[model samples]
Target: MELSLLFEISMLLTSACAVLLAGWLLWQGQRQRAMPALAGFAAMMALWCAGHIAIVQQWPVLGIALVLANPLMPMFFLHFAVQFVADGSKPLPAWLQRGKLLPVLYGVTGSIILLSWLGGGGKVISSSGFSAFFVFQGIGWLNLLYTVLLGIAAHLILWQGWRIHSGNKRRSIVAMFLAGGWGLLLATSFVFPSLGLNWYPYPMLLLPSYLLLLVYGVVRYQVLAINAFANKALLWLGMLLLVLALMALVSALLGQLGMQALSAVPASQLWLYSALLLLLSAACYQPLSQLARRLIYPGGQLDESLLAHWRAELQQAQSWQELALRAGNLLSARLRREVSVQLPAAGDTATGLHILCRRDSSGWQYQLTGWDDVTPGYRLQGEVFAALLLSSCRILEQSLKLADAERKRLDQQHLVELGALSAAMAHELRNPLNIIAMAAATTPAETRGHIQQQLKRADRLIADLLSYSGQLQLQCSRLPLKPLLQTILSQQDWQGVQCQLKVPDGLTLYADSYRVQQVLINLTDNALAFCRNQAQAQICIETQHDNGDILLYVHNNGPAIMPQQHNSLFQPFVSKRAGGSGLGLAIVRRIMQAHGGDVCHRTDLGWPVSFELKFKQQPSALSTQIQDNIND
Candidate 1:
């Protein structure tokens, strides 16, 4: 079989494959129409291969075919180049968009060739050497101009793409292929057949391998996204075009050797040979991207492992403290480094979710210095994860606030319980105290009267406790202090006591008269009790006005109080005498507070103990019944 026949058959098959693939790509566009330029480029490839097949076949109408595809080749080269490099995305200016003109230039060149072929060949070059293919022919030079402009445009766009693109090294592969192909393409326009050179005019087709690469990018990476299995299609097309071109060369050589016709060779043999080479080329383009990724990242590990445990601890982690601990443990296990995670102060949610996880000597302010979940690296934790941690901090803050509020509530409940217990205790003990007072009042003036008087002192202490605890049913009213004191003094029991009253006659104070009388009686009893052994045993009760209110004092000539133990003596459970319930002075203080007044201890001229009362202003007349009851 002649090699030229084999080559011709291969080119024919490759072109047919390209046409089929182009159809498939066009069909695919109906669904994903985002890649029109890719579809146009596909059609261009198919047409190009078809034109090459016709050229090798020497079809009678071959010149007509060239008219269709010659200029189309350059125009499509420029158009698809523009589309493919920019991924069909850049908008062309109005002047540049009438790109169909580029194709017409090739078509007209082919027409001139066709016209000469009809006129019986070789006239395509005039004897005067002025033929269109050899010289400008008024318009042939336009093709050269077109070629130069398009070439420059291609260079500029390619430079632009190359500048911004940081992709695989395929651009160099593509550039080499384009430069070689176009170099031959330009030289052929002037030198082919006209110069009588025996070399093939269409040897430029051999370089479609470069265009095949663009098909690979589109399929493998969706570079053009016309949706064809472009790598496979371009592989088949390139193998066909190369085999056909080589076969043409071989056929000419074999024909010169006087070889027999190779139409006898079965077409299947050529198809199989082309098929094997196509499959091989297709297999080779698969990238090592997956393998590269694994080598770079290694063992599915993240960079965050470099941060040690202690760094995690110093971060402001609230509820996520637990998460920080788990992260530390995992990091420690993986990196074989101790992970110390530090959190901000306990009970403070203000510093929440800020992590200070650290690796030994590799921490930034005790923070992890390497990549975290999505952050890529530190000095920048993932904003999303950080936000999640902050939300957890907020929750912790709310929980702390709730806990504090509950604690305060519990404390208030305890205070309420204490107050209730005091009220109940006062009521329980007041009955016994009132009974003692009753006995003391009834005790005979003849039989052990001194012992009965001592028993009276105990009663006074109990009475005070009852009033202060709210157990006493106080009968509040306007009462005259001077009249009440006079009534208590007028009674026979106090006649021997020898206390003088200097209170002005109608001095009034607002109070429960009975409670007021109880307070005065207790004060006088205390004074008399201390007045013993004095050269003159006497008590002085007096009233005066001060600061918009009436003030009263009960003074005694008695043993002076030491400078120490002043205000504290009025505290509950405190007393000068042993076995006192320590409530008398405390009661006086509380009653005064409730009445908007106060009671205090001071001293008279002799440094004898004295008690003072300041009362709210009121009418001077106390009720007659309270006066009568006191005097009785």
Candidate 2:
């Protein structure tokens, strides 16, 4: 093919690739305003490439129009780079921010160039005539001047972006620089010929490679979205293209060899030679394609090795801390930096050399430091390592949660066994105690009274144990709160202390009636005891509805519990009263919990000392039946 035709074909291919890349970028949702500018840049470059092809093909009018519009491409690139580097919150430099002037200039110059060409004032006299001082020369010099100026400005903006950006963003900017620089180098073919130098446009054939690099940046670094698989797809596509190209090359070589052999042999043997060449080409295609793929895509093996090693290390990690340490060591070796890993402090910053990876679900924060030597590729490695560290941390956390759950289950089983044994022993001792109490009744009244009191204490202890063990079956039903409170108050001795009931009428509770009664009796007894030493002793039982639940409060005009003792007060064997078995409140708490409610001491309430019981208000079949019976 003629060199000019080859250049045209190359330019056409580059234009198509550029347009496709521009379309893909613009179609993405996460591409901010900078991405649209980038898309515009790509589209304008494609148009410029098409203009070159048109010029080479002798379409002067169409070529001039496209060439006149070429300045817009670099301007668009500069605009994009400026925006890409700028932090949104900060204003850009006044000159850099004013992008409207470039388009205005392009419009004015483009019109001038078109008018000059139409007026027969501009014509190419020699290859160097574009820059030569010819009186009737077109606006070629002006176009060249503007192109150079815009290209310089675009590079400067890119450099600024590279300086300002960090981490993966800086890497993307570097990729853009390399790609754009390579395209500009190839573009020098036009410059050399314009300067009247003898040069082939073969360099321009590599223009499509520039677009590929930009596409690689978009995919590999995830300029749009952080997708690791996009890079994998790009790598696979590259490998496939390499294989196809090698197959074509092999076929071309075989065809050349067959033509030479046929030229040396007789015409009758031409068909035989062609068939043998065809077979040979086919035989070589796969092996050549495989060889090319191996040479061109050798990084796949290295990546796989790295991934496997990291995955194994991650699996062996015992905790988040261990994962961080191991990951830091791996990163240090890979990146050639002194790396330290630790949990992030409250005020730790993630700027500069620090890379912070946080997993809120696991409450883990990995701070990777000493990244001063980090390059773009090393930054990517750090990101992958951080991800691996996070995965390991999540696995470790889940394992710990499972282990803790298992431990709790085993402890509960042991508690059940111990409770069953205690209950059996208590039942066996109860009969003997009853007989002893009866026998003691034949003695003096005081001794008999003491023996009966001791027996009652033992019985209460056994009942408390049963409640804690969850052995007491609940018969939950709806009951009027007012009636229950009144019955309990009527049965209590009061001991000169005033008792008040503020339970609302018609208010109902769904709970085991017997267990609820037992809970209330325990609260009232404790309240009465605490209030006994008060100047104006009083106790109050009240109920209120809150958040789809019933809240019952037993209040006493007594000293408040100390803040330090609040948590342990509900635990078994913990009490503030003298000679108290300390099981009353514990049993009350356990019974309330078994009813799907909870008991808690409330110092912040209507009285100084109070205990609140919260119960869910959902109606059950038994509750509904009891309500109907009450109504009837």
Candidate 3:
């Protein structure tokens, strides 16, 4: 066959690929704003390649379509480049923003070219020297100039984006930049044939190389987020195409070599040769596909050793939380994307490229998100990941069961210890405290008061120990917030202190009133102690709504808690303040937990120190009782 015929075949194949890519991009464009421009670019590329095919077949109308599409192609590319790198925090440069008019101008130019062609003012002449190509004459040269300039401007915009961005965005920009640059540089050769240079458009032979670069960008950098299912289908299609092409080439070579026996074979025996070729293709498919994938995505394959290591690590996990964290981290590191392993909760169905995992009986769900790219081989890797996760989740369930059993055993042991400790405190310590109180009655007024204070402190210490050890049974009720805060403040010796209550008069909380009072007393007492020495000692009780929950804050203008102590601040027997029982915050935490709430020390509220109590907003029958009382 002639080389010209081969180039024509190549152009047809390139056009087919370009059209397919354009459709794929358009489908992707429905979900992503950046894809329409890219889709348009691919459509123009298809038209341009089709024009070459048309010119070879001596079809003049479709041949002219190529020239009209030429300038418009790069304009689409330029628009895509601008949209691709657009970040809300960064505005487009003034000059580039003004350059938006270029597309409109090019669109008008394309229209003019089409109108002129229809009016017979312009013509496409097939090159007599190169049978596979064509040249433009008259106003057609204007379109070529427009194409060259637009191509350069598109590349410049991509270059700017590549320079301005970093990380994955930068890498994506680099992919587009390099691909467009190669396409522009090689594509420029097509203009030479029309320049009266007898040079064949050899660059057209490498036209598919530009598409390959774009594919690399799409696969490697995730320039476009193709679906995994689509990726799998494409991979299969590609392999099938490869097999067919190889078979055709082999048949053509056999014909060229003039194999007498093979050529002289009867038509009835052709099925045997076809069957042999089919068998050969089948035998070669797996290895060839694997080899191609290995070359394309080197890190995608899961090694046996790595799988074994992951299994061992998952099985050995001490707790369910640690197991989830380890699994998520391992997947994130392997996939180079974010992965989250969590207990499935109410609200959203798993979001953003997530897989619902129902691997184990316990039904723990994990999501793999942040899928910026889907390469050819990732479907196989994704299957492997799912299998690994399924097996790992069973291990996670076992670990959680074991942890629960251990906790039950420890709780029984703790109850036994509490019983013995309580006995010791009542027998050994309470007798002496009672004696001190009795002796205080015989002492002078000032001396008696000092002795009474010491007795009360010792009694309170014993009570706190018992409270911390024993499980609480709550009697929840609707308590008015402002009045509750007022009663607690009245008990405080904050005569000269600036005590502010920011609680709404009608605000109410559904909790055990006694426990709520105890929590407030502990928090307020701590705040008062901390800020007592400050020049303008102040304490503020504030409430804010948070996602149906109420946040109560007790903040003070006191010396900040040391950063080093923040970690263990809520632990029992841990205190920085002198003369503290070291059980106040720990007791407060216990009470909050019993109410299905939580308390934490915070420093972000413009106060030196603050303790926030989050009251979970659970609906209750008594919720409207306080409001009724206020109305009355």
- Better-scoring candidate (lDDT), 2 or 3: 3
Q: What is the lDDT of residue 209 in candidate 3?
A: 69
**How many clashes in each structure?**
25, 1, 0
Ranking by lDDT: 3, 2, 1
lDDT of each: 0.53, 0.69, 0.72
For candidate 1, the per-residue lDDT at 576 reads 76
Estimate TM-scores for all models: 0.31, 0.42, 0.46
Model 1 per-residue lDDT at 356? 54
The ten-residue window of minimal lDDT in model 3 covers 623-632
Candidate 1 local Cα displacement, residue 409, angstroms: 28
Candidate 2 stretches with Cα past 4 Å from truth are 1-404, 619-632
The digit string of per-residue lDDT tens for model 3 on 252-336 reads 5666798866655543245335545766776787799889879887668767898897788767766545665676677667777
Ranking 1 against 2 by lDDT, winner: 2
Clashing pairs for model 2 are 122-138
Ranking by TM-score: 3, 2, 1
Cα shift from native, residue 94, model 2 (Å):
84
Mind giving the per-residue lDDT tens digits that candidate 1 earns over 1-632? Answer: 45344445544554555565556556654444434544555565566455444544554255224323334444544554554444444444455457675466457546644544354432233322222222233333444455456545655655555554544423542553455455556446334544455444344334444344444444444434433455555566677778766666665576567664763344455545666776675666455554564565444333444333323442444444564565445444544444443443322222322345222453222443233432222223333233334444445556767877888677446545655776677677767766765676666766547756565655554445544454334456767777788788675354345677787766667777876776776677667666754666788888888977878888887777667778577777776755566676766766565455789888744547788888876434333233211101
